[model samples]
Target: MRPLIIFILFYLLCIQVQAKTLQKTVNENTISFDYTWQDHSHKTQTLSFSLPKKLINNKYRRFKRYDKDKAMNHIYKALLEQASSYNPREVRVQFKQQYSQLSYTIKSKSEKKINEVEQKLKQLENKTYLDFLKQHHYIEFNTPWAGTKIKPDHKNFVIEGVDYLEPVTQAIRESISVKKPRVLINFVLSWLQSIPYSTLESRTESSGLGYYPPIRVIAQNIGDCDSKMTLMSAIIKKIYPRLSQSLIYLPQHALIGFQLPTLKTDKYTTINGLHYILAEPVGPAKYPLSEIADSSIGYIDAKSYFHEII
Candidate 1:
């Protein structure tokens, strides 16, 4: 798995007043939200969405922070249970603990027992690790070349987030009042840009301050660059599942790009012979599709950034 590295790139722009047109109404079983933001053309755009109270109250949306030690301990417990199934007289299971790490050793008078335990442990390790990540709504990703990292499970996140966010796309359709592809995308981008910005610490080292799943971005009302990008990707994917997308990572920031026809002035990167028009959803400063922040432009122009397609 490749770890998606994150850097905290700060901008001097003002945090847009997100509460200007915010409205929320709760019923017996659901919470309905309404928000408004100005598009690039200075026209006001409004969208409303409702989510089940039970869904929001569930364990997943409530907890955004990840604990590495706790995860390892969970895996260790599962392995212990698997290893203990064998006869202790012939098979011995040992552990060495140092801080957050837990290492294990399996010994036996019979070489076959050792092999059996080893093989079983391998299976258990993969199973338990995948289970923990899935349960926690996290994904272990690999870098393009060779490396592993952790991030939220983008695919599953999109699948679940799309249901509750259906209204978002619908409202977008209503706001535009037509099926103009470019205007539709820009509308979504501007709306996301209007959301107040939050910072994520080093993604490699920690989940940081405000890395949220797509639903939480709506429920909690804040997200960093990567968090917002993921939410936007999910929304766009729901609208156009066949559209190709990528997550472009810079020194301390992240962006989402779409593969589509482009004008000469549009900023894009070519990957595998496909062109992805880069868009900056991290805002208070609005930019439409085929454009990104000046800072992002620098990294891309220098060929110092990398991307992971979704």
Candidate 2:
């Protein structure tokens, strides 16, 4: 009886473990949607939606803001409609935790149709976002994104508003003196210098990247917190493709992980003997290029930038 019970439990556990697999493949032109949901059994069910670049950030993407089940259903519906146009066999979702990653499957008929629907949804989303952009007309200043003039002499609008551009735009500005990361350092630096700290709100919702460019962060230098973070992150990602999440994310706010070539902040990077440092400039403090790794407030990355309050 004991042997039979053990065998039964083992069989059920195997079925559970095999339910998910690798979610998706990354490419130059791929857009992914990952969200959690509740299955019929009321257990958490995760789904990863990977569609072709035809639709990157579309209207359907906003469903993430709604209820989880609703968002999952919306994505599933779109993928189903898309499958009608092509041939998709399965969709995959990965379950991520502190220690493990597992994936699940969505039976489908066509991959091409999924791409088509995704593109359509992306076009819709872009149109809506663009329309919103057209409605606002002011530059903002908040935190490190501050200091630039709202209406620049050349660009007309600025993000971090300083009267002039800088030699380096990101946290690791000091590193520019020693090494170059293969992209336009000055251009990105100018953007970092252009963030409007004064005009931005203190809070914004985060993206998967742990940054926000909320509506508040946008049009007004505030929107989703992730968008603002993206402004900073985009530069880093452009430079280091395989980098891990920086140790320093924000002041008094715990955010997501991203790639960084150096450990210039209070946060350390376990890479290449720790090559560089940069400040996690978020609020009213000034972080010098040298004191980035200082382990305290008013200092930079040496302290825990992602310390959560709750």
Candidate 3:
């Protein structure tokens, strides 16, 4: 009786990406488990699973495995579907066992339409977007960590305020001798830059802005890709935004493309040929969306997997 009660309680905590974790205690042929559930849905749910003194799972039936979140979800859905058929007005469930009869309750909210379940699923998915970006090379880099900048396509990119960007090629003219690639500051600048990354966690409104300048960006250093690209276009409007091939890549090898752009870039006009100056992030390079990624690991791209204008 106690084991049966435990099975039912353990099943409830398996939903919403919570893993179905079970612990088993053994004595002779009997196996008893007190499955403790935590780390999901904001509560502690526990139950005990016991097998008949003789029937043990030593047969290696991995289907009985419980660590999988998917399996936990399946168990949860099964429990809910089974529970739904019981009419609260018609029946009451109570059990007596030495381990103590623990009661389970399905809150009124759980009985809501399937759409509510979908909403919960969406919330879980939404929580994963930024994490996804961090695990993939979502942004692209043009050159290796240490290399001369590649000349881009011919075109002028636009800047709303700055009419004409004085062009300057990347030249190590000042330092004819490259430093022997010494590790400056005990680690990479990424560890020390204190660069702030952001998303629309809190925004009053959103809309389209055609073109902007770097002054605001230099000042606030915050804005969406819309303004980011707009500023990129403005800076390089005199150049071109290449469509066929990636305009940039890192020594590690990566790429992305801009359509035709037209701009006042810090460098030569028409760098993109269509005037779209490079719109890469001021700090870290973002990978293109085409790349397969898992943000459960740390990777980055300006392109968002969640959804975006570009």
TM-score of each: 0.86, 0.30, 0.22
TM accuracy, model 1 = 0.86
- Tens digits of per-residue lDDT for model 1, 90-173: 898987768988888988888998898889888888898889888887877655433577776666776677676776777667
Worst ten-residue run, lDDT, model 2? Answer: 148-157
> Which candidate leads the pack in lDDT?
1
Ranking, TM-score, top scorer first: 1, 2, 3
Q: Which stretches of candidate 2 lie over 4 Å from their true place?
A: 1-66, 69-190, 197-220, 223-226, 239-251, 254-276, 281-310
Best by TM-score: 1
Of 1 and 2, the candidate ahead on TM-score is 1
Residue 70 alpha-carbon offset, candidate 1, angstroms: 1.6
lDDT of 2 at 258: 31
In order of listing, the candidates' clash counts read 11, 68, 77
- Per-residue lDDT of model 2, residues 180-255, tens digit only: 5422333232233233344222322211222233222322332232343344444444345454424233433322
Better of 1 and 2 by lDDT: 1
